[model samples]
Target: MVETVVILGAGWAGLPLAHKLLKYTLPEAKDGLKVVLVSPNSHFYWNVAAVRGVIPDAIPDEQLFLPIEPAFAQYSSENFEFVLGKAEHLDPEKNTIELVKNDGTQRSLSYDQLVIATGSHIRSNLPFKPIGTHEETLAALHSLQKQIDVARSIVVAGGGPTGVETAGELAAAYGGEKDITLIVAGDHVLQASHILPSVSQVVEKDLQKLGVKLIRNTQVKEAQTDNAKRENDVAVAQTRTLILSNGSTLTTDLYLPLFGVQVNTGFVPPSLLDSAGNLALDKTMRVTGTKNIWGIGDVGNLEAKQLTVTDAQIIHLSSALPTVLTGDGGQVVKEYKPSSRKMIFISMGKKYATGQIGEWRLWGWITAYVKGRLLFVDTAEGYVGGKHLRHASM
Candidate 1:
């Protein structure tokens, strides 16, 4: 009997897990074992560079998008399968999942073990995540770049990393040429619970130096387009009127809101989710009260959604899954413990950066060399090739 492992979402979590299993676990496991990866997009999106990707000629399209199918061509069909579709529903009781394909067709799949890594999306329509199919994401990116080219003024809402990075990129590209403003709802930016005030202060100074106007303690209440008229069936580029929380109105040529993140858990059952609609997982990354189903990446509520956290979870789960597949009752797999030390890296355009690990603040040049220079796009292909997994195992 062939036992199947069905993994959902091929972003940071599912893609690496699938590769690791085929490369390491399947060869050692019982003869009958296979891995199936399902995702809405056929391409893996390198969204870490999305902040700079929006800027004209900042990063090429090839660096940001890579086909998911070709990455798995080395594995034989008998051991691996890649399904292009979105998960429509999950029936944990039956160990089955329902998926809706791109052509509006539905398919059902059953698995002995399941992994949920569906991740999350930005609140607004942005290229920060895999917004839809590969073509759709590319379209969004191109459209945003075109807007940025022509826009004289840009307003970015939300004080998070994306917002800060976007503002910084615009400032760097068009500092004295265009108007760039960043609106932070709180008194400081990078307001994640673990970030220190000093870190935020440093980031603020960097942004200010880059010529970004900081609007502190203010939020965008509403945004209304000044014109709805279409030019030759396409909506014309029009000014946006933003109503601020402080009872002021500001108009800009472009408005970008990078605020909240909504996890893609609609297919999951309510009982398995936390209050924020994220999968409730134990330290082992297993869904609470479930044996065969596991959760990772932004979809899991175990820790904050950071690339470093996601990478750690992927590495831990990959090592643990082989033991989990054996169904040995007495053997215990190591539990996943998230790091308590605060770690963050913010790239402020091409020239400057700021971040901290634990209590130590990284120098600007260190951050630039490590993250800001290429935004990790150089390693994008390695991720698809499972180089990270091979390196980790050694």
Candidate 2:
């Protein structure tokens, strides 16, 4: 009998791993080991570029949407298949997974080996406000575009990269016609990062030049929407008047919330995840206490959830899976160690960006060209086709 390999959640983590597994033929492997990838989406999304997606002149959607067939066709042999559905339940004891298809059908699959890359989902509740999902995200952007089209006063909540990026974009695009105010709960933009101090200085100077007001050490305490009835549509209120923790209030025609995201780990049981419901893994990316199981990328409880780190994790973990398959279950095992490189790219709206490579800060058009330009959307297109995107046209 041939061994079976099943990978769940064909997002960033699962797709790459599957492709690599299909491409690499193990030396000690048995005659036939079928590889199966399970995902609701046939295409892979470049998550890092999601923020840039909201920009008016950002990369086109076709470049960002990658189909999985080409990737599999390039790397996989005849023994690989893609199941168009979601893994609803995982039965570790029986080494089986229950799948729910988009067409409302169901099935169970047993895998001799499994990888759980079922990435994170947005959380609805937090100290910060909520941003909508899918169509909601697009709708909010459209409505804001309309508001920014005419309104003079705009108040943005959240001081993180998302907030800062939005403020920068608005200032760059509509600064002459709009008054942009940025509210940060902390003292500086990108507060949680370890970038050089000069980066923040440069960012603030640019925002000041663009006439964007920076309010630090403040939080939105209360938000009242322009149309109260539409408040429900906005995850946090669709506010016109926003009251701050510092007892200050401002009235505006448009409000944008750039707070953090909520993780949806409910799809997987808590037993497989940590106390915080993040996938708990031993050093080898294997789900703790679960046999023939692995976890990677944003789904894991690891501190860094950036796409760069996630991609690295997937590459490292997938390389070890072939070794594990050659050995008897527990006797021969390989340990996995994560890398220590931290990289972040922040889009300052328009076509400008600031990237932090370790402790050094590199800014300007190169940053924009590298990531801020098309958000590596063409890379996504290439992944789907299983060919390297030599030139990703912006």
Candidate 3:
């Protein structure tokens, strides 16, 4: 008997897990196992460097997007299937899921086990994550770059890593030629509760050195694009009128909002989700109240949404899943332990960076070398090629 395992979403978490199971677990299963991966996009987007990707000519399209289907060429057809669609419905009681294909067709799949890794999307329509299909994401990236190329003044909202990195990229490319302003809602940027106050101070200095204008303690309440304005009967480029929280209005040639993420759990059942709509998960990463279903990555509420945490969850589940599937009573299922220490690195353009691990702050040069220079694009292909499985095994 062949037991099918359906994994949803092929982003940072789902893609790697599929590769691991196909390489390490499928061959070892007593009952034959098959892995089915479902995603809305046909390509794997390396969105870690999306901040710099919006900057013109910083990175090529080939390096940023990889075809997802070709990566699984090593696996046999009997063991793996990649479906290009979005998960529209999930019924755990029947162990079946319904997906709406890109062509507007529907398909129903039954699974012995399910893994939810739909991840999250940026609040605004940006290329930070897979907004839709591969072509749609590519179009968004190119459109934003073209806008940045001609915009004389740009306003970036939400003082997090994306906003900071974007401001840095603009400053590095255009210097004082263009006016780039970053609006921070709180007193400082990188204002996550876990981050130390000192880290924000250091980041502030880095942005200032890059000639990024910082607007502190302010928020963008509303932004309206005015495209009909003309000067001397000649049409001008569209501009954005921003209404600030401080009762002030500022207009700019371009506006970029990089903040907040809405988890992609709309298709999940309400009973399995928390009040915030994130999937409720146990310590073992299994969906709460369900045995064969598991939730991970940004869709689950076990830990903060970060790539390191997502990677840790993938490593743990990949090791523990085989025991559950094969009914190996002798082997124990290891519970996932969330990391308490704060670890993050923010790259300010291509030259400077800032990071903190626990209570220690990393030097700018060290961060730049490790993350700022390339944004980990070099290792992105490994995730798709099943090479990450070897690294995890060791």
Candidate 4:
């Protein structure tokens, strides 16, 4: 029997891993291994630029979704496959999983090896991510954009990367016209947590220049949206309410919260995950005590959750996996250590950004040219075979 390697969730981690595995392992015939990518979404989205999508006219919904089919077309059908489904349950003892399709039909897949890369999802609905088909995602983006378009005042909760980028993008696009307030739970934005000190300084400075009101050392206590919505049982709270933990309140037309990303690891057993659903991972990205499985990307308890870091994992896996699968395939013999140098890029709209690689800090213009401009949406197309969908706006 030709052993199959099953990958769940085609997010930042799963998508690249799937493509590279097909490119490196299957085509080269790594012991006749078969690879299958299972995702609920039809498109392998570029989440790196998802924050820009909230701006009224910044990023079109069409540009984000890349057809996964074209990216791995070179691999023969004999060795590669894609499944549109959600993993409902995993029976690790039996090495089989129950998957639910779009129609609510269930199917069983038995894998010789399983890779769980089902990255994180923001709890609040603010157009930071699309949950379903391309049409559904398009509608979601439009709705969120509509909220932003009409709001006279906006309150953004969470000082993390997503909230910072959202505030910058919105401020850059509609600074003078709208009132934008950024509420950070820490004294300084970015908090330089898992990033460089210089990056936080530059990003906060640029945001201040953009006229963003920074409310430091405060956390959101309540959020109430007039146009509240619920989709797929996920509450699109807009993270509104404008209530602060300090007992102050500001009534805003729109409230966007960017923290609290829920890991799609409900299928994972409780014993394997922390209270927050984060998996305890070994040096080799394997779930602790699991012999035939590996966890990657934000799914693991890594400090940095950038796209570049996720890609680095794929590079390591493309080299390490072959040895493990060919050998005992029991204990993960391959080792991977995340780079000690703190690397990050915080884009402040298309004209400016702040990024640091190790001790090296990049200027705003250089950061803008590298990743701030278009938020790397252009470069992302290259990763998935550069397939341009005509239906997507130019």
Best by TM-score: 1
Q: Mark the 10 consecutive residues where model 3 has the least summed lDDT.
A: 228-237
Expressed as tens digits, the lDDT of each residue in 1-394 for candidate 3 is 9878899999889998998898889988988999999998899898988888888898999889989999999999999999999999999999999999999999999998899999998889788888999999998788777778778999999888778888887888788989999999999998999887888888889889888899989999999998734544533446989999999999999888998888999999999999999999988999999988999899999899987677688888887789888878655677899989889888877788888999888888999999988988898788777686322541
Q: What is the clash count for each candidate, in the order shown?
A: 0, 2, 0, 3
Cα lDDT listed for each candidate: 0.88, 0.67, 0.87, 0.76
In candidate 2, position 230 carries an lDDT of: 37
Q: How well does each candidate superpose onto the true structure, as a TM-score?
A: 0.96, 0.83, 0.95, 0.90
For 168-223, candidate 1 gives per-residue lDDT tens digits of 98898787898999999998999888887787888899998988999999999999
| Model 1 segments more than 4 A misplaced | 228-232, 328-331, 389-394
Clash count (model 4, backbone only): 3
- Error at 238, model 2, angstroms: 5.4
Better of 3 and 4 by TM-score: 3
| RMSD to true structure for each model, in Å | 1.7, 4.6, 2.7, 4.5
Per-residue alpha-carbon lDDT of model 2 for 1-394, expressed as tens digits? 6778898877766776776666563334676677888877665655555554544545454554556766676544657888877777888888899988756799899998988876664342211111322233345444544445555677877776667777887787775787889998887877765556677777777778778999999988877876532333633223488888998788887677667554545567777877777789887777889768887767787556656576567556666777677655653556766656556677766566777777778866778788666566656665555443223211
Global Cα lDDT for candidate 1: 0.88
User: How far out, in Å, is residue 317 in model 2?
Assistant: 1.2
For model 4, the stretches where C-alpha displacement exceeds 4 angstroms are 27-31, 226-241, 328-332, 386-394
Over 4 Å off, model 3: 228-237, 330-332, 389-394
